[model samples]
Target: MKSGQLNRRVIVQRATSVSDGAGGQVREWPEIGRPWVKASLWSTGRGAGGGQSAVADVMQDNQAFVIRMRPRDIATGDRIVLDGLNYRVRAVVDPNGRRRELQVSIELEVPENA
Candidate 1:
């Protein structure tokens, strides 16, 4: 595959350390490595509440969308749009666990325009 097409965006996301409601800590990706979904770009804004907020609230030129793909549709070199930014898939994987969810790491920019 051409490396040029592998352009992507990456953001270090934080997963909350959930308590079992008792006395235990657990970290969840919520949806696993952020999935790349296509959506129209929107303006940026600020948020008021705590916890996870919408990308539009934090991104400068934000894009927003609801993902519409089967878990298997994700692959390396695919273009993903998250928070109005373009990202290229760098790595695709499924961390060993009880589920078959995939995790993808994307880069923030592409050296060459595609």
Candidate 2:
């Protein structure tokens, strides 16, 4: 992967359980690392009816993205944050199998209301 292609900076976070001070643990996403990555829009999908509007129709948006960066300890449960949006990691792949680079597949889901 070319360094020039890594034009975007993103934050990687991992889920952790922290004491909530009420005798229970609360889930939290803590920043793990900030890395420069090459991000590409993989795909996008919208709600049914292909943009038809209806009161019962709930708009669902699924955006898939692929990021390439140097090999790291990223995992499936980890998340990538870009532009203040959180993306769930779906898959990780080492294309060349040489550990030189990693291709991570991440996705974001948006509801109609928000």
Quick one: best lDDT, which candidate?
2
Model 1 local distance difference test score: 0.41
Number of clashes found in candidate 1: 7
Runs of candidate 1 exceeding 4 Å displacement: 1-70, 97-99, 111-114
Q: What are the RMSD figures for all models against the true structure?
A: 14.7, 8.4
- Candidate 2 lDDT, 1-114, residue by residue in tens: 789989999999999999999999998999999999988776344322311222112222466677888998899879899878888887787776899988787878454488
After superposition, candidate 2 runs with Cα above 4 Å error: 44-61, 109-114
| Distance from true location, Cα of 102 in model 2, Å | 0.5
lDDT of 2 at 86: 85
The ten-residue window of minimal lDDT in model 2 covers: 50-59
Pairs that collide in candidate 1 are 7-88, 8-87, 8-88, 8-107, 9-87, 63-83, 63-84
